[model samples]
Structures are given as C-alpha cells and as structure tokens.
Target: MADLRRVTVRAKTPSEKPTTVDHLKNLIDKVGDIDTVIGEVMSRMKLESRTESQMILSQDTEGSMEWLSTNISKINYGQHPRFSVPQRITVLLPLEALRDTPYLISVIDTKGVEGTTQRPDLMAQIEDPRTVTVLCCSFADAPGGVPLSIVRETIDAGSDAVSADRLCLLVLPRNDEALKIVNDGGDVPSDREEGYAIREGQIDQQFATDGLPGIPVNFFQVGADEPEDIWRWLTSRIEAIRTAKVERIKRHVAAADNLVTNADVAKTRQARHTIADTMAKAAERFRKLRPMVRPAHLNLIAEAKKTHQNSIAASVNRKGSWDNFPVAHILGQGVRIDANLRTRDTFVRIDEAIEGLKDDFAHLSDVAQFLENLKDDVEEARKEFLTRVALAGRNLYSPYLSQAVDMWDKCEARYGAGSGYRVDVSAIFQAQFEGDPNAMTATEKVEAQVGSIWEQIVIDPLLEAAAFEDEE
Candidate 1:
C-alpha cells in the first residue's frame, strides 16, 4: 500500500479596508424604506381586506420633523420616483419612524418588475422581524384544490404590501395547502396536483384534482426547456446564484470598509468577550477532569509494568537452571548437598507473580472499560435526571439501581464468564522443564505418578460414573 499524503491548506487574509459609515448608511436607508410599507400592512391588514389601502398610521410627535421631511424629499427625488416616496403620512416611511411605532420589513421585494424567482434573494437581504405570516403558495397547488381566484388575489395583495418582497410563495407542488388553494379557484374542478410540498422537501406533484399535470409543469417550469432538464439546470443555477452572492457580499463588505462607528466597535468588543468566556469555560472544565483521568492512566501503567517484569522473571527461571530436573546430590565430610527445594519455591513465586499479573491485567481492563462507558452513562443519567427535574420542578437526588446495573454490564463486557482472564499459572511448572521437553524434573515425575494413582482413585471413577449417568 502507498502512503497517502494529506495537507491542510489555510486561507490567507485579504488586504481590505474596514467598512465605512456611508456603506452602512446606504443599506440602512434602503432597508428602512422597505420596512416602512411592511409596517403599515402589518398594522392594518387584519382590519381590512386586501383591496383596501391599509390605514392605521400613528402621528410622529418628536422634534426635527422639518429636517426629516427635507431628507425624505431628497430621497424621493433622488431615485426612481415611482418606487421612492416623498416624506408623507404614507406607510412607506414607517420604518424610518419606528422609534415612535412598530414596523415590519418585506422579506421578498416583489414591487420591482422582476420574476418571482429573483425575489428570494432580496428577501434574504432583509432581516425577518419574526412577525410576518409567511405563506408559501405553490402553483402546483393551483391545480389540486386551491381556487385560482384566491391564489391570484393572495399574490396580488401580498405583492402590493410593503412586505410582499418577504412573502415566500414557493410555487412548488409540495405544499398541499397551496395546491388546494389554487386548484379550488379554477374554472373547472382540478383532477390532481403536483410539486414540492412546503412542509416537506419531496415533490408534491401528485394532484388531488385534474387541473394540471404536475408541479414541474404548472409551477417552476422556467419556460425555456423540459421540466426535467429545467430541474437539472436549476440545481447548477442555484450554485451559480450562491457564487454570485459571495461577490455581492464582497461588494457590501468593501462599501462598509469605507465607514466605521462606535457601535461597530462596541459590537466587536462584545463578540471578543463572548469568545474569551467560552474558551475560559472549556479550559476550566478540562482542568477539573484532569485529576479524574490521571489515576486510571497511572493504574494502567503500573499493571503493564508488573506484567512485563513477571514475564521476564518467568523466562529467566525457565532457561537459567537444570538442577531441579536432575537427581538429588549428597556430599559428606566438610560439604553437604541435597535436593534443592528452593527450585520449588521459585516455581511457587513464578505462579504467584503470574497470578498477580493476570489479576492486575483484568483490573486495568475493567478500569478502561469503566472509563469508556463513564461519559455515556453519566450523560444518559444526567439527561434522565434533568428530565425528572423539569417535570417535578425540583432536584431529584434519589438513589438509583440503574447506575449499578450499568457498572455490572461494563464489568461483564471487559472480563467475565469464559473470558479466559485467569493467570498463566501453569507457566511456572512448565518453566521448570521447558529447556528439555523429553526430560521431566524429579517433582514432575513424582507428580505424574501421584496423578496416575489419583486418576484411578478419583478421576477414573468420576469419569465412569458421569458416562453411566449420561447413558441413563
């Protein structure tokens, strides 16, 4: 296998100037103008029908009306006169006067002579005041059950409102409610409808009435090509639109760089403060958890060291001496020798050490398992506790058997029944005769003879009885 190379590339900061006040001023001015008419419609829409001009204007009682009126006149004459308004008691300036009254801004800008598809971008520019009732009427719904007259009226009226630009009529077949609205209004009863449903992403092209073929045909056709091809084109078109948006953002940012203000400085300071606080909190939590993690890691290290030392000792003993395997030695007159029982002691020591190593290994593994499960169990318990607290409106510090059960499960997973977690105790005896497999030590030979007698007296009888029991 070839070694793979992966390198992370970082973006370089562009040499750009800070936003200027003029740029913010322009954005604010345009946004304010859109907000004005939206405010009026919100204030009076429920009171009157769509055909009626909404009228619930509050009077401005503050000073500097003269200056404001002059500014309004300049703006009205400055741009397209039909779209711009003179400083009047009209709803078009409500946002400009919002200090004295409430207002709304159209998410979509439908007033301009542009296609429906272009309006979402304009809406995206405006911040939602969270007061508007956004209706996503799809044209596919036109064929299902929705009355065409009602749909047309809704569009016409919404478009006339200041916040019409904010209206998000999806014109997709997905919205069953939209289909019902349009299909019902048709001259002939609708057979079925198709298109994307507003609440769900899947196409709601299935029509209840037979007014239209499907959502793609009735709505979102784009009129240039087949619906399937158009859908494919739209996928790429949406990406291009997103790319274009980046350029628009660049332009806005460039413009803003020409202007600066104390409010902007304050906002920056507040953001930095928030980031610092979050980082500090994270650091504090990690510091608190360090003590808990350290003990478990140290225990694991100690267990591993013990196991390594025992393994080395067992290996040394296995290859170090052969005195225990040979016959007993005896000498008289100034020197004496006898069978070495010390060898037996060494074997016992090896067995003990091996047992300890295995026990420690199991303990360490248990600890690791506990740690692995600790986070999830704690989180789950915390959530359960929190939920109880919410329902009872108090801290519930009751003891739980559930946590005990979880600990048991963790233990079993790591080391339990048939886990083969036992120490390599047989290694101690095997080590004595390891060098020469053909030859047995004195103790091994005696043990083998004792084993033969014991098997006849105990093991053979047990085996025979067990065999007879099975036959019965």
Candidate 2:
C-alpha cells in the first residue's frame, strides 16, 4: 500500500491552491493563504496526523510460503515500520461552498494566495438560489440542482460503503427558495420518504427531512436569535463526525486490512475489559506500597542549575572567586538528556512485554514480573551514571565552596524513587533540548530547571512511597 503519512491540502485542483505534497515524509509549513478554512483544515490535519514510527530492521515476507510463524509475523507481515501511513482526511468542498469568488462560471487562474475575498456588492447582485452548479462548475457551465442520489449514495449511506468521513452541508442564501427545497421534506410522505424519489435522472430529496432509516438532519440558522446557536450546531457536528470517523477508521481500516488471526482480534477487542477489571485492583496494590518514590536526581539537577546560575551572576558582577564550572555540560547535557534516554529504554522494554502478551505469552508470570520491574531499570541506570558523575563532578564541576555534594552517594529516597518523572523523561528532555542549547542563556537554564522541578515535584509525589521500603 502507498504510504499515506504525508498529506496534501490545497484548493481542489483546476484552481488556485494553498499547498501541495506528494511524498510521505514531507511537510509544506507555510500555507499559501492562512485565513481560509482550507488553511485551517490543512494545519489541523497535519497536527493530528503526526506519527513517530521509525524504520524497523524487518523485511516484507509476503512472497514466502509459511506453515507457521515465529516472531517473524510481528516483524514481517504487519505494517512495515519504515512506511507508516498517517491517518488523515482532506475535505473537498464544492464551489458554492466557497460562497464567494467566481460570481459566474469563469475559471479562477489567480497567480497567488490573494484576491480570494468575497465581494459583498458583486455577491449581492444575484445569488438566485436557483443557480448552483452540481460540483465546482457555475450555473452557466452546467445544470444546477445537486442530485439527491449523491446524498443517498454518500452521506445518507443506509446500507453499503459508508462515507463515514463526510458531513453534508448545503449552504443556501437568506430567504431563498432553494432553502425551502432543502429544509422542507414532510411533503414527500411516509411511504415515499423511505427512499429518495427518482425524478428524471436524479433522486429528489430534501435536506431537513428525517430519512426514517438513517441519521436525522440538523439545521444551523445563521440569523438565529441566540448568538451561540451557530457555534453550538457547528461544534456538535464536528465532534460527532470526529467520533464516528475514529470508530470507522479503527474498525474498518486499521483492524480490517491488517493481518492477524480471529483469536488475536478477539483478544484485542476484549482488552478494554481486561483493563477495566484490573484498574481498581491495581490501585489498591499501589495504595498499600510503603515509602513512595522521591526524585533526588531532580534535586541534583537543581543544585547543579543553581551552581551554574551563581557562576553567571558572579562573572557579571566581577566578584571574587567566580567559579568557572561546567554546569550545562554536567546536568543540562549529561544527566537530563540521559534521563530521557533511560525512560525511552524502559518504554521499549514495556512495549516488548506487551507485544509478548499479544500471543498470550506462556510465561505470563515472568512477563508480569518483568513489566513490574521495568521502572527500576531506569532508576538503576540513573544511579550508576550519577555515581561516576559525582566522582568526576568534584574535579570538573566543583562550584565555589558552599556545601559538599555527593551525586551518587545520596540517600536511596532520591535514586530509588522508582521511575519518577524520568518515566516521562522524553518531555523533560524536549523541554530543554529541542532548540539551540545556548549554554549561557538564562532562559535555557530555566527550561532545564523547570524540567527538573516537574520531574521532582509533579511525577514523584503522585505515588511517593513506591521507591522506599518501610523502616521496621
């Protein structure tokens, strides 16, 4: 299958467009026009469809004959790790949906992203609701009325091939006849209401009528007495469509196309029940733990941060004995970044364990034990690194005499504090390291400091006694 990650958003083709992308790994950041709805939709899709799947070292095994499979199914048969298809939807609006430019059937071969604004005077001349083109063409270019069959086939999909991604919006002018045609439907009667009446070549239908067998239509009167009426209608529709689309993609696309046994599907389908059952039990177990985790590493980072700050302040003041310490090199570059990596490694182990459970792992007890001990792996790694850093900190980072600092030899409450915020070290690392590391910049230092604060304060306190044992 073609990789769908890189999505393109532009004005429907044969017209001036906003953006374009053909490759899966590309992004066109600057929209040709930022003010339009298309621009908003484009930006929103890109943001929502962000994925971090990396290329795996596995190969496609489609052509090979297999009696049975090993770990190869995980590596070989499923979605190729390197070619992650991003989930996205590019809404295609009809020209009248534009509701603005091209008063007539004239082609808009505009040079750039400008001149898209609607002319109130020109627009007012004649929006004879009788004159809307089928798709993008003007009334003059072709016949006007939209076929109700299009609605039944797509939006009002009562039977097969659900267009779960579309929301049909028929925008008519104020006090226009077409508005009544769309908004009035009880005249069709009960028996006839079951299906769109075939008139000439197209099925005749109304927008407001309840299609007894399908979803009820909603109306958002633009000039409603309540100002929030329009917003309420739009927001509710957006959320409902979003939810329906998510379910459709999960059930129809993600689950249907991927390779797996029926038994595996049943397991995944029932996974929510498994989670629901274990939550209260897990909470009770956690509540019984003694002497919870503390983030002593954050304290070490904070102390290092303070030392770095003092050095900068002293240098600026031309004070006596200004300590030239490598605080950034030690804490900012070393410990903070390493903490993020440790968290990531811990997550990898967790993923492996979960994947193992997908097959109803024979060694369920062993896998459970491994999962339970995963966070400790992060703490152990942090302790070993800090020990070496402390020995080295005395010579390389002995900031002007204030208090003795022992990095590794700190109380177990610090390092043994379970995983702590280091469990989310990726965020902590990104908070500091995303941009240029201007070591001397005060803002950079503060970012690292805040990361440490979050690690120490927010994450560690959630289950404080997890890290330490009760002193009997």
Give the best candidate by lDDT.
2
Model 2, 281-388: lDDT tens per residue?
Answer: 333433222221222224224333333333433422331122342232333223323333334343344345434443453233333332233334433333334333
Cα deviation in Å at residue 447, candidate 2?
61
364 Cα displacement, candidate 1 (Å): 25
User: Whole-model lDDT for model 1 versus the true structure?
Assistant: 0.29
Q: Write the per-residue lDDT of candidate 1 for residues 1-472, one digit (tens) a residue.
A: 0111132344445665444244334544666775764564345333222232222334564444454555445444432222223222233434554332222333222232111111222322322323222233445333322222223322321221122222222344442333343232243323223312232222233332323212222244233225664334334433444564476566445434422421244434443343334323432332211111111112212222233333323322333111211001100000000111112232233234334433443333322222223222322332232222122211110111122233223323433334222122223322322333322332234333333433343223322321211111
TM-score of each: 0.15, 0.18
Clashing pairs in 2: 291-465, 292-464, 292-465, 292-466, 293-464, 293-466, 293-467
lDDT of candidates 1 onward, in order: 0.29, 0.32
Q: Count the backbone clashes (under 3 Å) in each candidate.
A: 53, 7
lDDT of 1 at 27: 44
